[model samples]
Target: MTKKGKKGPSVTAKAEDRHWHGKRVKARAAKNASRTGSKTLGPRKPGSSRAGAAQGRAAERSSGATRRPDAPELVHGRNPVLEALREGVPGTTLYYMADSDERVREAIKIAADRGIPLLECGKPELDRLTDRAVHQGLALQVKPYRYAHPDDLLQGTAPLIVALDGVTDARNLGAIVRSASAFGASGILLPERRSAGVNAGAWKTSAGTLANMPVARCTNLTRQLKAYQDAGCFVAGLDAHGGSSIANIPAADGPFVLVVGSEGKGLSRLVTDHCDLLAHIPMFGHAESLNAGVAAGIALYELARQRHT
Candidate 1:
């Protein structure tokens, strides 16, 4: 029954009806959120595969490894993304963007003409993926990162390598990488722990140097340097107070690797002992020491200068 101002139903019955209605509204909102979140990363949008989706959700909830690299991942940048699109096309080439007719647009056209999918998004979402990157408003979705061995870098080239002892800082690593790339180095080696790996900032600092440089993660540094020694690459350690001035080293005895230790501590004793030479940059001014990155640049340039002549 209805009233002018209030319903005439029993209080218990009214409460039960209100509760049921609330659940229905909540269920509809939840269903929409679930559906909207099902989009794939790049251009490939899949229809809701409910049966498999439920199983995949269950596996994720249990923290299992159903997580496959099943779909290609997105890479954002002008050069790296370009490299992936140009090199990765045979398998799958899909480029996505929000803004068209810019560099991003050009990349999109390239991908589309190459038979790759090109998807669009609103400006807000594209910015979020790149974190305000200078993507030229472009990003390419492709396969995972593939690592190569140290020897690969030395293919038909001289042996010049940089071994990062414990440089955990990404900027330092990146800056050092720029130096390494300019100096005609072959590869870079870092320990698995207490060292930095490739991330966004490092990539930016590397400035496409990463694309050319071969990097390897060693399980054990002490053992790995020995391997380089066995391969006939003389190892040199850089220190603030070291034995020899880097300039004096003649170019005739060539093909070497340089080891730079952590910023605070110049060199771990173990790593320094293994080096065939310990060289220092002569800081004439009052500054006690140089930044790990700056020192690395000087050292690398010294090596490069020696080799060029």
Candidate 2:
């Protein structure tokens, strides 16, 4: 698909999932969503300004019906609420069960320090805010997420970057971001359309990574990759089938952009064509692939290991 007058990664959906991303420097390609039934917000190139805007629009349109314009929408579970309160992201209300356990109260103590109000409510109240939401006796009502820009990550010297394409699972997206930050990646990118944007679940998945990691969203993935190229960095994609082993390539550890595709489908064709290198992790047995998060963790470690070595 074309995004903002630029061509984006293309895919045909073969029996086996293929990857869709090009290699480049710091800038990143946005994400692309498949058109099974949902709306198409548009593909995001690597360096496009519209990436984050597109993501905001998609969240509005996709969840517009369920969310209220003004009210206390809930973020369930202790961790999600705890992180938001600690980070000072902003909140409307804090809800906890009247009989909330010890851990929940401790989390509330942290929120209280920030002057965030804590409401002690009944099971019915928690039930309404969450239908089997797994509140764990704690939930928070907070404002929507705020995304950063690619240039924000590039401010530091030899900054590391990560670009995600078509990662639909919020949990995976969150875990990946948490891993990125844990390993000291400077920036993270997601497409405006199909990829997972920051939400409560994603936020929780990060285990507070959103608070620390500088994540960027874009309208077009290819354009963003091009922008990274102009900045004097290398870009690469993780593919199960590719030209070089992940351990053999040097770019995996350099100041570059690392692109990962959807959980099932690897890289899209359009993004693949634009890549400077396609690297695969060497498999020893019948195993052909790995989880998106696992792949990211291992790949990122390889890069880190290379830089240190």
Candidate 3:
């Protein structure tokens, strides 16, 4: 008989070996899939790359969901929107919910005449855009105001600059801009923070003067005042208890920067220290203080008179 060195493995054993190998392969694949799923569902720690990516996505969504800070401002209400359009406030678009009202029709006409894009949106959309303010079926998207450098106002001989210290009222700022333009002021200076910016309210209150006036924003008011001083401009702070009257200031005849304070508080301590002189508006009436807008108007008139004389 032929010699057989060893008995070959049984067919049953061979089949069992294949079955075990297949089960092992399937188990490994399922384990890998579970691990990947866990990673997808896992909570990320703060400051981790994954967390940062999630935060970035959230920020993007938020920016898209609401109006951006630098976006064009919306002037709501039929009269306000119409007036803004009439005053030629730079506008990109005119949005209206209804055109039945006369004011709305007029505004639509004005916008069309000015070649501003007209967008007909629903009431809910208008409310969302205007922050639920009284839109009255009309809204005008005004262009953002462009600011000038603080040094840019140094042009012209004996340039007069009005610097606001802590004025936070937009309407007050608008009024001041009106007065500054009227008195031939070179420009208006404002602190970047804790101050009112050129907004719709300011545009309305300015009565078109904002278009002509140049407003400069500075990061540090005190340092900007020093820079102006170094440039041969006298820095004067308007104070109720100032040592000298605004009319008698010799600096008014030369390059000057008149700093106006807030209505509630006069000049800040740092600004007061940096001032070359503190000048007050003479008040014979019993009124102890004036609002920033009125005070600025009076002070500017005095300074203008001094310069002209």
The numbered model that scores best in lDDT is 3
lDDT of 2 by residue, 86-190 (tens): 766566678888655666777678778878788888888776666556787878776676677665566443567889877776767777888897787987888
Residue-level lDDT tens digits of model 1 in 1-309: 111232111222221233233432333233213221221111112345685457435533332111233423345666655654554323144435555456565667678777776667655665655544455556655433355555444443246878988676666776788899887887788787877665544554565576667777767777767766555455677765454567754321355678887655566778866765666677656555566778888888988888888
- List the candidate 1 regions with Cα displacement exceeding 4 Å: 1-97, 109-117, 130-136, 139-143, 153-157, 250-253
Q: Which ten residues in a row have the lowest lDDT in candidate 3?
A: 34-43
Ranking by lDDT: 3, 2, 1
TM-score of 2: 0.74
Off by over 4 Å in 3: 1-72, 97-103, 122-125
List the candidates ranked by TM-score, beginning with the highest: 2, 3, 1
lDDT of 3 by residue, 119-167 (tens): 9999998888876767788878878788877877877757899999877
For candidate 2, give the lDDT of residue 296: 83
The C-alpha RMSD of each candidate to the native structure, in angstroms, is 28.1, 11.3, 30.7
How many clashing residue pairs, candidate 3? 0
Better of 2 and 3 by lDDT: 3
Give the TM-scores of the predictions, in the order they appear: 0.62, 0.74, 0.70
* Candidate 1, residue 22: lDDT: 47
